[model samples]
Target: MDLNKKIRVFVVDDSMVFRNFLIKSIGQSPRFEVIGHAINAFDAERQIPQLKPDVVTLDIEMPGMTGPDFLRKFLPKYPVPVILVSSLNLRVFDALEVGAVDFVRKPDVKDEITSKQFVSTLLPKLLIASNSRVRMPRGTVSSAPATTMEARQLQTPTPRTMEHFAGENKIVAIGASTGGTEAILDVVRNFPANMPGVVITQHMPAGFTAMYAERLNKILKMEVREAKNGDKVRQGLMLIAPGGYQMRLVKRGTEYFVSCTIEEKVNGHAPSVDVLFNSVAQNARDQAIGVILTGMGSDGAAGLLRMRKNGAFTIGQDKETCVVYGMPMEAYKIGAVCQQAPLLTIPSIIYRQLGLLTK
Candidate 1:
């Protein structure tokens, strides 16, 4: 936490070559100090308590005790922030749900270009993870994770009525970055299948959003899919902005649709929350609800403010529940949030906004 002290890092991977490469590259950074390296979970478990690194880089696939399993076992004891270094593996999301803070996709092969790309992704992720708080590895306190139906029952009123919501053509715009994956799930899982259209922009890469959308569709009651060039924003459907593309809301008559474009990164992310929020501000005005969840940077602050100024209902995740508390904090500071609540409470707040639920 001291500004003068470099962030301590521990590297864990089964490949000796990859481990050394990480050490050599990460050691060169002025902001980081590679305190230790481990070739497997057992090695990491032995050294991590003694080293107490600010952040740990772990590979998801190893000889034994995979990264998620390691996190499942070790995080309850040590509680150090962890970042997963992986390829196109969905198990990284599993680790994140347990305790891992973030991840960087490994390049296909080790080369100069891939190395540079990996470092570019890893550094900021590490910075965020080093500062992130681990709260009992996320799912431990709950006997089992809440299903979408359970969350819906808890957060909304009975009978699952959409009479008001569908007629009004309301849209919900959500944005988050670092700790967004699970945070978004926590919030949206609470919504009933008949709720108004919802659009999300979580700062993920191109390949991952598709997988994320697929996972969400399977678990959630409503239809959830990655946004395309001209996807309608309608009731009982959630559209996630494609990674590496900027998404904007456009109104056609009384209905709303999304425009996904492969544009330059805004605020350091391609599917920038600002881009989506700003568009929602313009198109939906008072008909929309904007929610900003936990994230690492100030991406959605200005846009949320614009939404509030245009009479949109804006909610922010309170600091106590946030993993990083950066994006929502910025939005709150700028008078953007009409109500600040915990992650699980946001969907009910949305229902209240639409008069769907009294509480």
Candidate 2:
């Protein structure tokens, strides 16, 4: 790949500093060029078609028509790759579920140090966005709010095979984003309630997490609930990070308890996989297993790699089973993953790893 070919990009953001900083950072990369820049969705609406950029960096919260609203309209007409640059808010994940290609966490670029730091991370996500293909519009997708059967039905499943686990009080930490609902449902349905205690981070809103948990609880044998501070980790139970907060595990002696904290978002996601995985790596070490499921971007790669390095087993859903293979691909490329398997085979893999597989 030639870094000097100038991969074209369009920037849609309300912040002048961010727009300037992003363009400057991309320009430094021998690989990217900013062809167009817009202040908000309305401006983007007029500029995007004319520029026809290969990649678009969008800010979800903009004045005069938000990014999501713009996406609701412009995406069907001109299907181009979009990478959302969002604040430290869970709402970023909501944009992803609506079909944004990837995301980058935006830091306040008031100083040169922060500006330089932002560029270092932003360029990579943009390059990845440039290389990837956006989902083609089949027709008018639903405008209904992110819940209801209509919303759930629109989710597409990523194909995967499973591996058997040895079965223990295996702590399984799973992460997902764009198309995680169905994947989590599939895995939980296959798992027996007596299966290991599981913790999950699905990019979702606060209200949505409760509903999702209730829905999953009705179908899967294991008990599912949104994580609250000081909750215990026990077999046959699953804890999901509530929207807008980061959930981690704190061990009081030998028992584990859920700890929730309000922190600046990392990787544009609250309840970020990075925070959960890092905490698990430090406290659980080899005793726990980390799994990164379907999602866009490289949010979990670093943390999962830390888990593997600390001797904990790590799993990444393979490309075939990922709606956007970005997260797993980044983890796999850096040797952070112990195994890469499809979704269906994941349960059995868990069983085998936990020594539950019997002849």
Which one wins on TM-score?
1
Query: TM-score for every candidate vs. truth?
Result: 0.93, 0.59
Candidate 1 Cα deviation (angstroms), residue 117: 2.1
Q: lDDT of each structure?
A: 0.88, 0.77
For residues 1-359, what per-residue lDDT tens digits would candidate 1 score against the true structure?
Answer: 67788999999999888888889889888999999999999999999999889999999999879999999999888899998898898888888888788888886545889789888889878888888977556546556787764465455443346655432478899999888899898887757788889999999998999989998998888899999999999998999999999999998988899999998999999999999999999999988899999998899999999999999999999997788999999999989999998776776778777777644
TM-score of 1: 0.93
lDDT of 2 by residue, 1-359 (tens): 56667889998889888788777777777778789899989999998899889889999898878777788678878878888887765555456545577666677777777667667767866776776656433356656565553344344232232243344445889888765765676566756656777999987655667767776787777799998999999887999999879999778888888898888899988879888999888888888888888777788889999999988898888886565677888989999899888766676566667765552
lDDT: which candidate is best?
Answer: 1
Model 2, runs deviating above 4 Å: 133-170, 175-196, 200-231, 235-254, 257-290, 294-315, 321-359
Number of clashing residue pairs in every model? Answer: 0, 28
Candidate 2 global TM-score: 0.59
